[model samples]
Target: MALMITDECINCDVCEPECPNNAISQGAEIYEIDPNKCTECVGHYDEPQCQQVCPVDCIPLNPDRVESKDQLMDKFLKLTAQKS
Candidate 1:
Protein backbone atom coordinates (compact mmCIF):
# COMPACT_ATOMS: atom_id res chain seq x y z
CA MET A 1 0.00 0.00 0.00
CA ALA A 2 1.04 3.57 -0.55
CA LEU A 3 1.36 5.98 2.35
CA MET A 4 -0.85 8.94 3.12
CA ILE A 5 -0.18 12.02 5.20
CA THR A 6 -2.97 12.78 7.56
CA ASP A 7 -4.10 16.16 8.77
CA GLU A 8 -2.11 15.54 11.92
CA CYS A 9 1.04 16.43 9.95
CA ILE A 10 2.97 19.17 11.73
CA ASN A 11 4.25 20.90 8.56
CA CYS A 12 7.71 20.57 10.06
CA ASP A 13 9.15 19.41 6.72
CA VAL A 14 10.59 16.23 8.12
CA CYS A 15 9.16 13.45 5.99
CA GLU A 16 9.82 15.03 2.60
CA PRO A 17 13.53 14.39 2.55
CA GLU A 18 13.27 10.83 3.82
CA CYS A 19 11.30 9.46 0.88
CA PRO A 20 13.62 7.44 -1.30
CA ASN A 21 11.29 7.60 -4.27
CA ASN A 22 10.82 11.36 -3.97
CA ALA A 23 7.15 10.61 -3.65
CA ILE A 24 6.61 13.07 -0.85
CA SER A 25 6.23 16.71 -1.75
CA GLN A 26 5.25 19.94 -0.02
CA GLY A 27 1.56 20.51 -0.39
CA ALA A 28 -0.29 23.72 0.34
CA GLU A 29 0.01 23.03 4.05
CA ILE A 30 1.22 19.52 4.78
CA TYR A 31 3.28 17.01 2.93
CA GLU A 32 1.57 14.97 0.24
CA ILE A 33 2.52 11.58 -1.09
CA ASP A 34 1.97 10.91 -4.76
CA PRO A 35 0.47 7.46 -4.81
CA ASN A 36 1.52 6.88 -8.42
CA LYS A 37 5.14 7.45 -7.47
CA CYS A 38 5.05 5.70 -4.14
CA THR A 39 6.32 2.15 -3.94
CA GLU A 40 6.44 1.89 -0.16
CA CYS A 41 10.20 2.27 -0.58
CA VAL A 42 10.23 -1.23 -2.08
CA GLY A 43 13.15 -1.08 -4.49
CA HIS A 44 15.24 1.53 -2.70
CA TYR A 45 15.09 0.74 0.99
CA ASP A 46 14.34 -2.04 3.41
CA GLU A 47 11.42 -0.05 4.72
CA PRO A 48 9.44 3.10 4.04
CA GLN A 49 11.58 6.11 4.93
CA CYS A 50 8.79 8.64 5.38
CA GLN A 51 7.15 6.46 7.95
CA GLN A 52 10.48 6.19 9.68
CA VAL A 53 10.97 9.95 10.01
CA CYS A 54 7.48 11.36 10.47
CA PRO A 55 7.49 12.85 13.95
CA VAL A 56 3.74 13.04 14.49
CA ASP A 57 3.07 9.57 13.15
CA CYS A 58 0.85 11.15 10.53
CA ILE A 59 2.07 8.86 7.82
CA PRO A 60 -0.02 5.74 7.44
CA LEU A 61 -1.13 3.23 4.85
CA ASN A 62 -3.22 4.70 2.11
CA PRO A 63 -6.42 2.77 2.66
CA ASP A 64 -7.77 3.83 -0.69
CA ARG A 65 -5.01 2.11 -2.58
CA VAL A 66 -3.57 -1.32 -1.93
CA GLU A 67 -1.13 -3.24 -4.13
CA SER A 68 0.80 -6.47 -4.09
CA LYS A 69 4.58 -6.78 -4.02
CA ASP A 70 4.80 -7.42 -7.75
CA GLN A 71 2.41 -4.57 -8.37
CA LEU A 72 4.45 -2.25 -6.23
CA MET A 73 7.56 -3.34 -8.04
CA ASP A 74 5.95 -2.50 -11.33
CA LYS A 75 5.08 0.92 -10.06
CA PHE A 76 8.59 1.39 -8.79
CA LEU A 77 9.97 0.55 -12.20
CA LYS A 78 7.64 3.00 -13.83
CA LEU A 79 8.66 5.72 -11.40
CA THR A 80 12.35 5.27 -12.10
CA ALA A 81 12.01 4.55 -15.79
CA GLN A 82 12.56 8.18 -16.70
CA LYS A 83 15.50 8.78 -14.44
CA SER A 84 18.53 9.95 -16.34
Candidate 2:
Protein backbone atom coordinates (compact mmCIF):
# COMPACT_ATOMS: atom_id res chain seq x y z
CA MET A 1 0.00 0.00 0.00
CA ALA A 2 0.99 3.58 -0.52
CA LEU A 3 1.61 5.84 2.45
CA MET A 4 -0.33 8.97 3.35
CA ILE A 5 0.43 12.03 5.40
CA THR A 6 -2.43 12.89 7.69
CA ASP A 7 -3.45 16.24 9.15
CA GLU A 8 -1.13 15.49 12.01
CA CYS A 9 1.81 16.45 9.83
CA ILE A 10 3.75 19.37 11.29
CA ASN A 11 5.31 20.33 7.95
CA CYS A 12 8.67 20.16 9.66
CA ASP A 13 9.96 19.17 6.19
CA VAL A 14 11.74 15.97 7.14
CA CYS A 15 9.60 13.58 5.12
CA GLU A 16 9.87 15.29 1.74
CA PRO A 17 13.57 14.66 1.26
CA GLU A 18 13.32 11.09 2.55
CA CYS A 19 11.00 9.91 -0.21
CA PRO A 20 13.00 7.92 -2.73
CA ASN A 21 10.24 8.21 -5.30
CA ASN A 22 9.70 11.92 -4.60
CA ALA A 23 6.09 11.13 -3.83
CA ILE A 24 5.81 13.38 -0.78
CA SER A 25 5.19 17.06 -1.34
CA GLN A 26 3.86 20.07 0.51
CA GLY A 27 0.15 20.26 0.05
CA ALA A 28 -2.01 23.28 0.78
CA GLU A 29 -2.26 22.18 4.40
CA ILE A 30 0.03 19.21 4.91
CA TYR A 31 2.37 16.92 3.09
CA GLU A 32 0.61 14.71 0.59
CA ILE A 33 1.59 11.38 -0.92
CA ASP A 34 0.92 10.65 -4.53
CA PRO A 35 -0.40 7.12 -4.72
CA ASN A 36 0.83 6.81 -8.29
CA LYS A 37 4.42 7.37 -7.22
CA CYS A 38 4.36 5.79 -3.79
CA THR A 39 5.80 2.31 -3.34
CA GLU A 40 6.27 2.50 0.42
CA CYS A 41 9.97 2.28 -0.35
CA VAL A 42 9.61 -1.38 -1.33
CA GLY A 43 12.60 -1.38 -3.69
CA HIS A 44 14.65 1.19 -1.82
CA TYR A 45 14.50 0.29 1.86
CA ASP A 46 13.22 -2.25 4.36
CA GLU A 47 10.80 0.36 5.74
CA PRO A 48 9.21 3.58 4.52
CA GLN A 49 11.86 6.25 5.03
CA CYS A 50 9.36 9.06 5.53
CA GLN A 51 7.54 7.22 8.29
CA GLN A 52 10.82 6.60 10.00
CA VAL A 53 11.82 10.25 9.96
CA CYS A 54 8.45 11.87 10.67
CA PRO A 55 8.38 13.11 14.24
CA VAL A 56 4.58 13.22 14.56
CA ASP A 57 3.99 9.69 13.23
CA CYS A 58 1.41 10.96 10.76
CA ILE A 59 2.40 8.74 7.86
CA PRO A 60 0.28 5.66 7.46
CA LEU A 61 -0.64 3.12 4.82
CA ASN A 62 -3.24 4.49 2.42
CA PRO A 63 -6.28 2.26 2.65
CA ASP A 64 -7.56 3.50 -0.68
CA ARG A 65 -4.40 2.50 -2.52
CA VAL A 66 -3.78 -0.88 -0.94
CA GLU A 67 -1.55 -3.32 -2.80
CA SER A 68 0.26 -6.57 -2.15
CA LYS A 69 4.00 -6.85 -1.83
CA ASP A 70 4.26 -8.22 -5.35
CA GLN A 71 2.18 -5.36 -6.66
CA LEU A 72 4.37 -2.88 -4.87
CA MET A 73 7.46 -4.53 -6.33
CA ASP A 74 5.92 -4.33 -9.78
CA LYS A 75 5.26 -0.64 -9.31
CA PHE A 76 8.80 -0.14 -8.10
CA LEU A 77 10.16 -1.94 -11.16
CA LYS A 78 8.02 0.16 -13.46
CA LEU A 79 9.19 3.35 -11.76
CA THR A 80 12.80 2.20 -12.00
CA ALA A 81 12.40 1.47 -15.69
CA GLN A 82 10.91 4.89 -16.25
CA LYS A 83 13.92 6.51 -14.64
CA SER A 84 16.32 4.52 -16.80
Best candidate, lDDT: 2
How does model 1 score by TM-score? 0.93
lDDT of 1 by residue, 1-84 (tens): 898999999898888888878889999988899998899999898889888987789999999989988899998888888784
**Count of clashing pairs, candidate 1:** 0
Candidate 2, 1-84: lDDT as tens digits: 999999999999999999999998999999999999999999999999999999999998999998999999999999999999
lDDT of 2 at 3: 90
What's the lDDT for candidate 2? 0.94
- Model 2 worst lDDT run, 10 consecutive residues: 60-69
Off by over 4 Å in 2: none
TM-score list, all predictions? 0.93, 0.98
- Per-residue lDDT for 28 in model 2? 96
Assess each prediction's global lDDT (C-alpha) against the native: 0.89, 0.94
Candidate 1 ranges with C-alpha deviation above 4 Å? none
State the displacement of the C-alpha of residue 54, model 2, in Å, after optimal TM-score superposition: 0.4
